[model samples]
Structure formats: C-alpha cells, structure tokens
Target: MNAPTTPSTALDKHTGEPLRPTDGQLALAEAVRNGETRETHGTQTVPASRYTDPAHFEAEKRALFDRLPQVLCPSALLPEPGMAVPHDQTGRPLLITRDKQGEAHVFLNVCQHRGTRLVEGEDVQCSSKLVCPYHAWTYQLDGRLLALPRADTFPGLDKAQYGLKELPSCEAGGLIWFSPQADADFSLAETLGEDFSAFAMEQSFLFRRRTHTVKGNWKLIMDAFLESYHVLRLHANTIGPFFKDGITAGDTVGPHMRSAVGRLEEVEGVDFTDMAALRRVITFAYQLLPATVIVPSPDYVNVMVLMPQAHDLTLVEDFMLIPEAPATDKARDHWERSWALLDGGVFGSEDFRAAELGQQGLESGAVDHITLGTLEGGIKRFDETVQEYLRAVN
Candidate 1:
C-alpha cells in the first residue's frame, strides 16, 4: 500500500468535515471488531439460466435497464464548459456534453438533418458547438441547432424543432445519470447521491478512466462485488491478504448494497478521529443497484458502470478518481502506480476474470443453479431485489 498522503485529523478539503466515521459506519466497524457478519437462513441458489437465458436478458433490459435511471458517466468527464463525450456502451448512441453554462446534458448522438451520428468515436471533445461531418449541421453544446449549410434551400426550417433529442439527465454525487425513457424520475438515484456525497465523490478528480469489455453477464460482474467470498481465493495474489476472511458486514439502502470489509489485522487502541488509522482497518464498498460499484481506497476511489449488451457480454466503464489532480511528478507516479495495481491488476485480472470463468462454467450446463453460502448472502439479497423489479414489470 502507498503511504498516507494527508494527515488523519486533517479536515476534508471539499466538505470541510472531519474524516470520521458515521454512526452507521461505526456500527459496521463494531460488527467487524466483534466478528459479526450477515448470513441467510440457509443456502440459497439462483438458477444458472438467470445469467445465460436470452429471454431473461431481454426482460431485464425492458424492466430494469430500460425503465430505470442509469449512470452514464462521471460529471468530472466534463470538468469544464464546452466538453463532450460519446457514450455507446448502452447500445445507444449518446452525446454527453457540458454547455457554456456548465450544466451537463445527454442527447442522442444523431444529427437532426440526416440522422447521422454527430460524434464518431469515444474520444472526449472540447468545443462550443458540435458539427456533423456528413453535413455542416452545427449545434451548441446544449443541443440547440446553431447553423446549417443549406438553410435557404429548406424553406421555413425551424431550428428549434431540429435540435438534438435529449434524454432526461441530471448530475449528482459527481456522477451523471439519465433515464432511458423520457421521464425524469430519479428518486432512487437522489437517495444514493447522499451516500456518495458522504464519500466526497462530488469533489473528487478524475485521474483515469477506461472501458473494459468483460465476457460475462452484467449481473455476474455485479455479483462479484456483492460479496468477498472469493477474495481469498480469486484475488489471493493481488489484494486478498489485505482483508480478513469472512469479515464483512453489509446492509441495503433501498436498492443499493453497502459493505464494510475488515482488514486482516485489526488495529488495537487506535484513535477513532484518525481517518488514516480507521481506513487502514476498514474498507468500504458500495454496489449501486443494477450495476454501479463504488469502492473508496485510502487515497483514491474506483467507480465502475456496467452496461449489459448481451446475455454473456458486458461493457464496463471503470473510472479511477483521486482526491485531486497530481501536481508533482512524484504525486503523479504515486497515483499511476495505485491505478495500475487496483484497476489493471486487481479488478481486470482477478475479479473480472472470475466472472468470465463462471460464465463459461455455467454455459456448459454443468450446474443448474449457483449456490450461495452464508458468507455470500449479499448476492442472494441483491438477486432477490432484482427479481422484485422484474416481477413488477411482469
């Protein structure tokens, strides 16, 4: 682990609050200290078809990913005005931009003139206006149609009606969320905003972001984060030694799951006010509903957005966020090393690899259902919540 960068008792530069644990988080620490963990009544099993069946995948798309609000990207991706990025992982062409007023907007990446894509690749662009390459149709960052090459030819063309088709979107807790539908219902997302804000995510800086294509179901990827049962085995060479076996406590905030992982060696007689000492003993993980995972490290955070494209294919946008941009070469090197270890080594090679392997095994029809033991009860709980949403739509 890298050395601590900030003093423990130092106030948070963003929230101006003590970096102490909350009452609920303290309860989790107490649970860890006392060796208390959550367990189900008995072994629970979810059918293998849940991860392999295409009909079920279609159902999930309609009931959950389609109807609900999902994370598009981090607001820091557009840290300043006149910044835009193209998002195509959701299987929809989307153009996310920050207007001159610094407000984030999500629009269909289609030009109103010829239905051609306004932006081609996934690169982030900085410009006051977006111009369609096919035709010289120009639009402002806010989706307003600014100019057209042959405006005189098309008599009485109302630019207002030809603006880009924008989806309902909002920025909260440092993330940008948008609904697949036209409605703007973000009640659940708003609730999660409070939880993420507690981590000071809104004030975090975007250090690095990468897109990963995982050969597994989106839920399979999500199931990996819901429990630490495989950490000792799957991540043994990477980050396993840092956490104690079966020393995690989890609770659900509405549809989201929150977990506290106890370190291998418990700290004795440590001061609660020392954030560094506290973090050394406890690692927190959050599984935000359908497929966003937020894990806060000692000096940085990882936010992953999982988008399911097929029954066995998932596109993961992994974001590494730091407390602030590295100002010195030494600081930059530290952050870079940290990012390489966690994002590239731990998650990419270990956790995601396990998910893909599980998918292969399940595809062979070797197992009818995957069994979850007491230590993996969080997976059962998350699957049950998913079923409720599916049931509602059915």
Candidate 2:
C-alpha cells in the first residue's frame, strides 16, 4: 500500500489536531453554499435486472460480498478481554472474541469435530476457553484447540492441526473489520484510507440495538441512505423539517463516502469558536464501502450494517452509539425518546417503506431501469464502485 495521505490542513484551535472534513471545507462547499450538489458527467440509467436477477445476485455474493472486507462491529462491543460475539450472516457461522492479550480475533464459529456453533448466543464474556456444546470440545480465545472430553479416544490426533480457522481481522478508528478470506499483509488503514484515522472515534458504547428484516434487496436498502432527494416528501412528518431538500454534499475516499448535510441550525449565519462548535451544527455521514453506514448524530451515531439474505430480503442491524453508557434514568429516557423518534419515525416509516414499495415495483417487471439525476451522485458512485470491483474480478 502507498503511504497515507495527510488529513485536511484545517486544524482545531483547542486541540492542535486536524479537524474532520467539514461542509465548510469539503467538496460540497460551493454547491452547498448555493444549495446545489455536484452532478455526474451525465445521467446514468441502471438496469432493474441488477436488482432482480438471481444470476446477478449470486455473482454479487462472489464478486463483491465474498471477496471484499466487511465490518463486524465497533471495538467498544468488547471493552475487555474474554468478550465474545456471535454473528449469523450469509455464509459460515462466524464469531469474534477479544483474547487475554486484548487483541480481537475472528474465526469460523464451528467446532472441528462436529461443527457445532462454538458460541450459542449473540455475545458472551468468558475468562477461559470457549467450549463447543455438541461434544464439549474446547478452544482458546486465540483459536488454539485446548482440550475435549476423552482425548485419549482419538488416534494420531493433533491439536495444532484441529484449531479453529482464523479469518483476516483488524481494528482501527475504534471499529473492527474482517474479511472472509485471509491476506497475509492485509491493511485496514490502506483499505479505509488516512482520512478515517483522522476523525476522533471516541470510546462510544452501544446503547440500543434493533435488528430488522426488510423485504428489499440489500443494495436497495443501502441506496435509500445514499440519496436525500426524497427527504421532503418521504420524511415530511419526521426529519424533513430539519434538512433542506436535496441539499447535501460529499466526497469519496476510495469506495467509502463522507457526506455532509446542512442542518436547520446552520441555515442562519453562525460562527464557530472551535471544531466542537462546528460539529454541533452540521450532520455528517460516513458510508463505509460496500455495506456499512455510520451517521454521527448530535447525541449518538447510528451504525447500520446491511446483510443480504436473498435477492429480495435483507437483514439490517441498527446500533445507536453514545459516548458513554447512560448513568441516569433521565439520560436513558432521553436516548429512548431520540431512538424512537429517529429509527421508528424516520427510518421505519420513511426510508424503509420506500424501499419495500420500490422492490414490489421492480419485481413486477414494470420498469427496465432506474434513472439517476446529477443530485444523486452518491448513489451513482456506489453502483459504479460495485461495477468496478466486479469487472476486475471477472
């Protein structure tokens, strides 16, 4: 990988640290100032078959999903050693654990003998070994086969050869990432880029997690988040009042995106004393390449992990991250209120409803393609990124 690039030249006065790219400094500044965003070189109409065909869906799993690196969760999920997390995804049963050394590891969640899932539930904390329930075969947090019941019964058995298969894993910017296959010198820093390291991803704790199964393609689920063109009509009763119509600006870091939108608070002229003041007024979203999205909100960042179940179904895990766990009942109440307002009102009612409806339309064979305007450039870039990856693979 090439050397990392320097972060933005703008520095915060208080910390002497580089400020995260703000709407004031990033690509959308001029357009955002004029209430416009960058347009594509030309309008592109993507075929509807890309969303409906089974062959194309399978190709995507192999070309995009299987080969690319994917996010597991935030590092805060495992604050201490011995913390274990089990995830049910598209392929093999997978589990994650922080070892005694405080290092995170990802592994196939199956036991070698009978292939029972090593961990039963969503998460756990074990100071010792992870024991398989099927045969009581035990393995260490770092993937070493420790012991099993009646070890003497096996002839020429090698514990070293039977250890759990570890997957490629890395942690950076307070988040964990993994790839289905391992690369000896895989660098998350290279894949994510230097700009990601610049942001202060504080010691945020997961507050409320809500998982939902949506009747829409995974890409369709993601596309809803990429464009703000329908905010006014779709989110009329919810967050639309807070944001201007189709007024968003963003730039891509490789396939990853960081977009900023003008909040109602920023509409009137305001001066900032520090970077902290600036962050309060604007909304920034980081659409991590392929499938994850992290939108840093006023109180918490909403982390959305989209897992494709089938061509027409998607499993989304939505996590709300706060700087610290709520210490008071009032604080918890405030979080609950905010979550209900955003997730229930905006996402559930506004964004997701649109996707399901769109899926019904596409599957009806009524439309051959979906049109993209210059305003929805972010959505175009996402499709282009997938095409680029698939082309190289093919």
Candidate 3:
C-alpha cells in the first residue's frame, strides 16, 4: 500500500498565485525593518466618512461581504441532518442537513412558493424532510421539491425546476461560508490568501462566546481591535503595564494585518524571564482581514468576528478556545485565570468603551475626517483596504 500523500501545498488552486502585499503593507514591512515604533499619541485620524458614509457602507456589503471568503457561520453547530440557522442580518434562512447518503447540503432558507422562510433556529434535526410551516410545502433533505399541499390547484407546476434555491458554500476552519451573491468568482482560500493557512487554526476550539448589540459601525468595532497604541492610556489598569513601550506593527494584503506589543526588560517590578513565560501563556493576537481577530495565547485562544447590521449598529461575537484536555488541574486553572483576566480587562472594558465613543463622535458629526499617522500603520493599511474594496465594488 502507498502512504497517503499530504494535500497539495501549492498556491491555492483557485487563486492562481500567492497574493502580493499591498503598497501600504510594503511600507509597514520596511518600517519594521528600520525598527520604527508606535507613537505615544496619534497625530493622524481616520476620516469620519470611512465610518459614516452610506455609500461606503453599501460598497462594503458588495466588495467585502459578498466578494470575500469569510466564515460567517460555524459548521460544528449544524452537524446533524435537518438543522436550520437563521441569519437575521441577511434575512435569509440557512438550511443545513444531510442527504439520504449523508452528504451535507446548505441552501437558502426560503420556500420556492411565495418565498416563505422555512427554518427558524440555530440547529434542528430532521429524519427525512423539512416541512414548511406556512403552507405545508415540503422539501427533501437534498433540497428537491418533495411535496406541495395543493398540487392539482395549480397548473403547469414544474417540481423539478422549483426546488429550494441553493447558495455557493464551502467549509473551512470549521465554519460554513456562503456567498450572498450567486455569480461571485471568489474562492475561500483565494480570498483569504495562502499566508492565512499558516495560523494552524484547526488546532483551536471554541471555549467561550459573548455576543452583543453595540451602537456603532462595525468598522468602529474592528478599529478597536487592530492597534494597541491605546493600551498605555485606556487599558492602563489592565493590559497596559504588561505591554512594554516600542510596540511595532506590519501589514499584509487581502487586508490581513499583524502587530506586536513589546515586552521589555526595564519595567520596574516585572521580570523579563517571567514575562516571556507569561507571554507563552497567551497567544499573540493577529487580525484577519475585514472582520476577524484571532488571539493564540499559550494557554488559550480567543477570536472575534464582527458583522455589520446598519451604518450605525453592529453585531460583535467573541469566542475563547482552550486545549481540549489539560494535563493537570493546575494547568487548567492557569488558563481559567487568563481567560477571566482578558474577559474583564480587555473585551469587557476599555475595548468596547473606546468603540462606543468613536461611534458617538461619528454620529454627532464632531469630526469630518480622522487621520492616520506613521504610528498607526495597521489602521492605515486597514483604511486603504477599505478604500480599495469600496472602489472595487462601486
């Protein structure tokens, strides 16, 4: 017998070649090589239009959400046949189920007749068919039209042609991704690029989740996560002291970014050796393009993905994942402590507060344009990507 060959390691089969870094990315990389650091105070601010313009928001829906390969829903949540999940933001019912042969199928959750929504919850198990509640329209697990209540009442009804509408979907990183538009030519790996696969995301699991409605543009929420410059002032009592001065950041294309906060040796009571050990206790944070932030701490991993609802409202979901099994209670306890600290200190406090303020400022028309300085390389790259995506769609 031949040993199984590993999956192909070439540039993603769909994208043609490895993605190139954007000009903003190249400049950030060069700055990193020169040992440039973040400034204590930002001199440039992002333009308010980036957060407040309705045209820009519509463009984002087309270029970023419709065209990108993002993991909008998790696959594990729909493991069984007959499961249905509703995406309230998109007003599309998402149906997940297995065929008679047990292959997974995903389709838009709407009945072909009169467009009534078919499914209503996170997950549901069905034995053979999904019966629509509105008029008893039934569909097979494979999405073929199974039955109609009044077949003879309607003439020229084509059962073969009236099946459930299907969406383009692919599963990766343990999540189900579907494109809202049918004709989009983007592939998941191609849109995210080859470098994203380097994060070893499959090794992680979900451990904690918090979702909330915030009064802010989703971009404002994302901006809160991209840079650590505010750590010294806003998070001073929490994560500030742990992060040393001289923090640096770099950017990559496809809108992906990387930033690092230094842990120096000169802090008054903190020991570098101990801090290095603690740094291993938490994975470094890396921001995926558009809306996901993944933090791989030594003891646990945390991720946040923001979905936009309206220009002024957003849905933010956060998840914490730890190793499936810890060797000892002490090890498990250590992770628990780290999770609590992060939850209360960062996510629960300063992070959301700053976004709330930024949201209010945009709403109040207090500023028309916010600037981006050399210190905010990550934010600069993010703004540029937003602009490019807007232009691509518009």
- Candidate that scores best on lDDT: 1
Give the per-residue Cα lDDT of candidate 2 at 149. 88
Best-performing candidate as measured by TM-score = 1
What are the models' TM-scores? 0.93, 0.86, 0.72
Q: In every candidate, how many clashes are there?
A: 0, 0, 13
RMSD (Å) of each candidate, 1 decimal? 2.1, 5.9, 8.5
lDDT of 1: 0.84
Superposition-based RMSD of candidate 3 using all C-alpha atoms, in angstroms: 8.5
Predicted candidate 2 versus true structure: per-residue lDDT over 72-160, tens digit per residue: 77777787888788887746688888998989999889999987778877755666688888888989899999998898999789999
Q: What would the TM-score be for candidate 2 when compared with the true structure?
A: 0.86
Give the 10-residue window scoring lowest on summed lDDT in candidate 2.
1-10
Instruction: List, residue by residue over 283-345, the lDDT tens digit for candidate 3.
Output: 245576567776645344566767887777777776666534456787566656666677655
Q: List the residue pairs that clash in candidate 1.
A: none
Model 1 RMSD in Å is: 2.1
The superposed Cα distance between candidate 1 and the true structure at residue 120, in angstroms, equals 1.6
Query: Of the pair 2 and 3, which is ahead by lDDT?
Result: 2
